[model samples]
Target chain A: MGGMKKLINEPADVVSEALRGMGAAHPDRLKVDLENRIVYRKDAPRAGKVGLISGGGSGHEPMHGGFVGLGMLDAACAGEVFTSPVPDQMMAATKAVDTGAGVLHIVKNYTGDVMNFEMAAELAAADAGTEVLSVVTDDDVAVQDSLYTAGRRGVGVTVLLEKIVGAAAEEGRPLQEVADLAKRVNDNGRSMGMALTSCTVPAAGKPTFELAENEMELGIGIHGEPGRQRLPLAPAKEIAAMLVDPVLGDLPYQQGDSVIAFVNGMGGTPLLELYLMYNEVQQLLDRAGITVARSLVGNYITSLEMAGCSVTLLKVDDELVRLWDAPVNTPGLRWNA
Target chain B: MGVENFTNWLRDAASTLHENAAYLTELDSAIGDADHGSNMDRGFAAVVAVLDEVSFESVDELMKKAGMTLVSKVGGASGPLYGTFFLRFGTALAGAEITPATVGEALKAGVGGILARGKAELGDKTMYDAWAPALDAYDDAVAGGADLGGALAAAAEAAAKGRDATTPLVARKGRASYLGERSAGHQDPGATSTTLLLESAARTLA
Candidate 1:
């Protein structure tokens, strides 16, 4: 299998060691709480400001944690391998990150993530009196039964929402504004993913799931869960259609609609494949009479070293376009106005 | 169950997790990410470290300490779910001696905490699937005038059955649920591990 290979002391120690590495890599910008297994911005709990927190599993590197800086998340709770971070971690993060302005939880739509964050919110409300507002990101269109799902699985747009909503919060936007903007992003975005090969979780010391050599799983989630269906591997254009078509078809991105198109790699896939897929996706969008206002092509959110990609389209307005262009600095992505 | 028996049960449970840490992760690999065993091992290790420091004057104190330890050490869904279980259990047993009826009450409190925390119904293909039925069986066993060990053993058996039932379920919650239909045909690692916990209770408390 041409998949992820990592160097670590043991499968069990990856998260803790990674947190330690993060602390060492960016001491000025980040703080690692070994006790709580949480990553925090060094100067967090910025007085009188709404603290933003998000987290899930460990493989989606530079996400919830790496985004913990200026104009992004204030703290992120790290869970086991691909499991959602528990309520205690969220509660700890919420309390540590809270100021007088309340705290916001940017949760992906997964049962575990939602439930854990909910419990944290309850604890924060009862014990600490910390005002907590949670916005769930469910941009993935792959999962059909929304009622059966813990809702939709939050995918690529989460990274975008974190940035946009983080900016709003940084500008001292009220909790309600930041929350509403997050909801707006959720309402306007849709995503679909595919897996070329399975990802090997370090702790598992093996792949959690499998994929055949000639086939790929469609509508895959970040955890290497098999998608809506499996199909023979095809050309990048066909694959892009497989991904973008569902997202666009589900939402019907129409003429004159401007979108933020994101082509994200699942991890093991190279940048070369990502660029190729992005080109194909762009062509598909153009053919559908949709205009691309902003585009990002890379592995912003990943599932270990799974070989695959996902496409996310967020219909944009003037305000969202401006926020997308705003200056922000984090480990995974950076831009200056 | 007396204080000594409960303490013994707790220690044995910790040892079981420690011994089967890799086994738990192995089960996780089949259906979920492979960390349940390790997470439980880490949490219980912390519990063991502070076992001596806890005041057993009340069951609540010991359980509360265990819950906090798991929260501080374990970082995944199990941490919060199991931690909340202990926390609510402790609250239920506050200022009380350990007894079969009290144990049933604590189990109910734990199940309630899991429900409030996870929002899982009986068939969500989560640890709640095992826990909910186990609590119900524990209640039935107690009401039928079963002993503590017998009651726990019944609960453990039900949990094992519940865990086995998840093999064919379409998961509706957690990471496995994202798999949808693909999530079927795999025994839920969380539920399986939860059954182990009850089994330990049955064995140690017996």
Candidate 2:
């Protein structure tokens, strides 16, 4: 109700100051350009390798920016909280990371993000003659009527897409192949989210929306965009069923279909609840005869201190599992580094 | 009018946005991510700053610079949509005489850029909802032998009506569309801002 009890010193400086802290904290792996709001892999521009870049608004930490490293994204442009990055930052990132092999953009299909990236790509091609390929992720199952809405909102699958496609690019795959792989990951992934509370934008200094004490919003998006419905507060298992069923149905994951099941916390929810939700999710998938080939649980993509969780089911094959298992070192995610 | 008129329009719009920032944010909070007010205010302030330092040789150059400033400074659907509007508006006005018909053409061209960027249709509960009506009003007034100020005044009035019309229609574009039926009762922030810019033009451009 009063000034948001956030750790930020000023509402305007949250994104920049956070970048400064990120720079200091992970100097070995990342080089933060505070002025341009770009986080780069320290040893970027690896010749003969296609560059990988993704970006969106801030508040969803360890995504886009945090994924920039050895076997992941080459660069990420950070925007204001819940706002898309402007073309200037994107243009610079595209130019900075483009080795001769060209650069591939992994964008989430939000209106602002899509348009700004399109303008940046147009500018890059027109002025500098740089080759740029873009694949926008629209994997959320929340938007039921895609014919009436702005397709499906991109949610949790973006994290998986960057890692998988980033690994493909690290194999010296050409731009077209890398782009196609990113798109493939996008098409195969499906996500559904639910929020227990609303998040406050720093400048707004209040909750973006509200929910009654005994209510929760289902089909939520990352930035606190309202989901399909609000229902009475339910238990962890019931909530998990609500989140997982839509994802399973949307992609129509058949029996014997193996998948990477991810149970992610919205920034405010605790890890304990996520793990509990994961158990329910696994049991549901088990009943459906779908095998959980791989699993990730935690706050990989999140809204700002919003209490909720999203379930993402990526129908994966051996190729996806292998790429996702590739060695990677970054601040937010590191495996077999 | 010359570049000074555009400079004034941007400055005036900046003040208006700053004044109404909280209201816009409130509207967005209902159906969107609650940053439209701040984004528009920030983008227009940048445009005003550019006007203060850079002297322009032509109205087209001035408008193009404003568009580039908004594109570079603002981040969101508003940035590209408004930025493209100004850019195309300026492009259409290059070296042309400032007649009522030419301004109407420029307005249409600017709105066209918005449609191309957003891909939103009428009754989509977006800025285009306000724009479609405003454009029609501008043409009708121009055809009725109205002066430039009178034509823009009519357009601004129609835009206001369209902005009010967005309150009951469900959103079909942008972040608000995610709410589906829940988005119906909230006035679209983009449409509200579009009307503000048109009203500012009525006050300054004419």
Candidate 3:
């Protein structure tokens, strides 16, 4: 009762109800497989195009599901809040979206997500002869290896990779080329996130973790797993620096590097603070002699009502930039053709 | 032991998980997403519902149904891990009568499936921490000519000890590992639930 109030009815119905709302809101653009908990583009399995699929927990809005459209994902599997989707859901999505060109899976590097996707890919291959390739995004620099105990988590960079690679798939790239592009984006991008507040899972009906008003968790994953270090809250500039420094250093972005700078809000933060953080992030990049070729500032990938922001820096060449500017029509992200 | 005893073991497990759901959630709240308790409880409730509605011809059918239910209903990592455990365990006993040796082999298959699914080694501070030791103890007891109940009791004790041992170890897998050093001192929720599973087996399977 002492946590942030969410506007959900029965805790068990949260994901299904939200999907229902999404389907109602975008019937022309999206298709919801209610039983399997998959979100598909209305025109999926585009005859000669490579199918791109991605999914994870439900709390992160505008992520795997919201990114499904003409130039993004063909399908997304939704798990319960903050839990990885099961293999069956992934298999259904894979088979539903696969054109003759085969399918590509954009997986985040969480253990459950990776395992489930692997199983689904195997099932898809053995059952239907659907050729599937997968790329795992692990960009968070908070904990290289920590308690949610795998490799570094896939964080903000996932949003950018989806966009860039989605464009490639939309252009009728082969499954191998699309898979390679997705992996390149993951390798060139680095991200770091911090949380000012913890989000609540609907079924749990309470905050997953408690944080003091003055304290913040740095290097948080999308699931509200405790970050690498918790420290006293700082100003937007310092926080931006805290996030940017590790990202810039880890990848060692060169002074003349052209990059896409993404500032993402963890669901609860407002646009006003996000812009302020973006301003600080820009200034830091300028000082480091990095040119921001493209910038996306919004709540594209988010934790459920957790108040914080993550910064992703992806080094891009001409081709990547061109793909970034391509048309994308989805509920979460849209651009003119 | 017979099919009735196997069914009782599952029923006891469901009840035990229901009783300890909050405790499991509390442990998860420390380092995980805080749904382990609720997820397991819902899955077992579904399993029990299925158990009541249908009369099974064999223990394998009952367990496979329970596994399928967990996979569909739980909707998390636990769903697949627990689901795979039951599916493999039941498959190992397919069309065969449940004997003390078969029970041990079934448990071995189940634990092996969990290890394959979750990919955790010993000391990773996961449910494997409990399951590995429990499996060893069960095998040791059976090898020493212990009865079914005696071996199960030994397995339960070892699992409890393994659950306790999770504290103070750095997590190398699962959600809890995200905390690094901070993860130590909090018992793993998966390990706790696994202990409940073994305890239920000890209490009713014989």
**Per-candidate count of clashing residue pairs (backbone under 3 Å):** 0, 0, 10
lDDT of 1: 0.84
Error of 2 at A137 (Å): 0.7
Please give, for residues B1-206, the per-residue lDDT of candidate 2 as tens digits.
77788788889999999999999999999999999999999999888888888899888898888999999988999999999999999999999977789889999999999999999999999999999999999999999999888999999999999999999999999999999999998899999999999999999988
In model 1, which regions exceed 4 Å deviation?
A1-5, A31-35, A42-48
Model 3 off-target regions past 4 Å? A1-4, A146-148
Residue A55 accuracy (lDDT) in model 1: 93
For residues B147-167, write the lDDT of model 1, one tens digit per residue. 889999999999998999988
Query: Candidate 1, A273: how far from true, in Å?
Result: 0.9
Lowest summed lDDT over 10 consecutive residues: which window, candidate 3 chain A? A142-151
TM-score of chain B of each: 0.94, 0.99, 0.97
lDDT of residue B41 for candidate 3? 94
Query: Of the candidates shown, which would achieve the greatest DockQ relative to the real structure?
Result: 2
In order of appearance, the predictions have TM-scores of 0.93, 0.99, 0.97
Displacement of residue A176 (Cα, Å) in model 2 is: 1.2
lDDT of each: 0.84, 0.91, 0.89
lDDT of 1 by residue, A10-126 (tens): 766888888989889988788899878899988888987788999998888867788888888899889877878777788899999888788889999876677678778988899
